[model samples]
Target: MIYTGFMFIVVGIIVLFRKIYLELQNIKIIIKIFKQQFSSTYRNNVQIKKQKHLTDLSNFIPLRSYKVYTIDQTTSLERLYMLIEKAGKTTKFSFSTYHDDESNKNYFVIDFIQPSSSIIINVEISKISHVLNDKLQELLSIIFYSSNTIYTWNYLSFPPVDFLIYDHIYSMNTDKINPKNFISLQHQFKHWYNRTFKHDENCQQIVDFVDSDGPLCSCPYRPCKFPTDTWSLSMAIMYTFHEHLQLNENPLEQCLAITKLAIIIEEGRNRQRIEALRSPSIHT
Candidate 1:
């Protein structure tokens, strides 16, 4: 009887141990799930905070109010000419272009800033026949000759060559167009650190402040190295404004971004000048 009682006790102990083991396993699974949930929540929170910070930073430079007019075959060049005439002859013009691969067409965009608002003119170039018949030459003359300042992103090869390419493709006469009048923003942005605007005979005229090519902003502890090549339009915009410039095939958007970048650069330079004037070192 004692042996049988001992056997019963052993069986009961084994069953109890098995139950305890299963409960411990259940607890471990619950803890693992909790840890995964906590990690996922933490990551989500971090992403949300990062997006909020970027949004707040973007507010530093407000977007300018501008109207975009897309001109195609249906639109009248006379109407566009009237608008251009109203902007006055001396108004500065920011120019950009786009080429659509799918449609096999070209786009020309012009942005003009006004006291009240800004205007963007986007011209669609479909065919050589349409380009010649639309009196586009007269419009080109008005834009090229009327504006004292013609701002292009890269005058060296990209946009400066655009005219020549167009001429080759359409056999358009570019004799009246003067190349010396075109100003390059890429050249300007690369040399933005010199404070004292200095240019040699070979250098194109910079619109506002001139600074040498180098990294402008960084932590004081560890300054960044100077860039080797000229900054592209998108890179310059991000550097100056702390904003991402979305690049696409839309010529109108490109013009707008270019114009805004120019404005921001001027404003930043003005602020720096004001700060310099107020500093004690200036009086010293």
Candidate 2:
């Protein structure tokens, strides 16, 4: 009787162990299935973002009939002023600077464009006389006083604009210049990108996929997730256009890039407005 009782107790223990082992195997299988689903969802989300970027590129509008002028000391300031005056309210300004190590002075390259006239002017005021600098300052003040909207990537941090604005602040009549006329394209891009893509479903998935507790994808290539921190101009360009823009201090190139980005962002906003109008929400 005692031997039989012992045998029964042993069998019961073995049975309990086997049940626990089977449950663990089932749990492993469940985890495998979950990982597969997660990976598929992540890939799908990335693909959606890529498609949107490609769509943006396809909608690009090329600048037409624009003439670029590199104006120096010898160039006619009168004609330049006339061109600027004719440019009217559709002018954009950008600037770059070159520091002379020997002279220890910063050289300014001021570039501006008139969309209506399709004229781009690049002026080198570094080598110009004090009289010429004053005239240039006057020209800039005129743009500020006028209804023309000036665009820059980051005017505060931008060397050319910074020096121009601060150095000649007294001369430019700071009170008359409406602060609203200047558009910082970098700030605009950040706002646009954050609204359009940064907080999207795909970005969230990217956060999840790279989580320590989550399984990593087996694929060799991992698409970069949108930044959660500070957004730089280079990052903005890379994500928006899917092309790497070489960083430089060239105001002409910067201006062109800024203009293009603004147009693209504006176009996107217009489309969104149209879509919202077309698709009204049904009230329950």
Query: Against the true structure, whose lDDT is highest?
Result: 1
> What's the alpha carbon RMSD for model 1?
11.6
Error at 193, model 2, angstroms? 1.9
Stretches of candidate 2 exceeding 4 Å from the true structure:
1-65, 89-117, 127-135, 156-161, 164-171, 198-228, 247-251, 269-284
TM-score of each: 0.59, 0.52
TM-score of model number 2: 0.52
Candidate 1 structure quality by residue, lDDT tens digits, 102-141? 8888888887766556777777865534644445555666
Clashing residue pair totals per candidate (backbone < 3 A)? 6, 0
Writing each residue's lDDT as its tens digit, candidate 2 over 1-284 gives 99999999999999999999999999999999999999999999999987876554322222333467665567666766775565454455544444445546444444455444345666553456656556666666666677766666676543335445445533545667666766777766766654454333442244533331112322212233333344465555555544444434333444455655666676675424423322223100
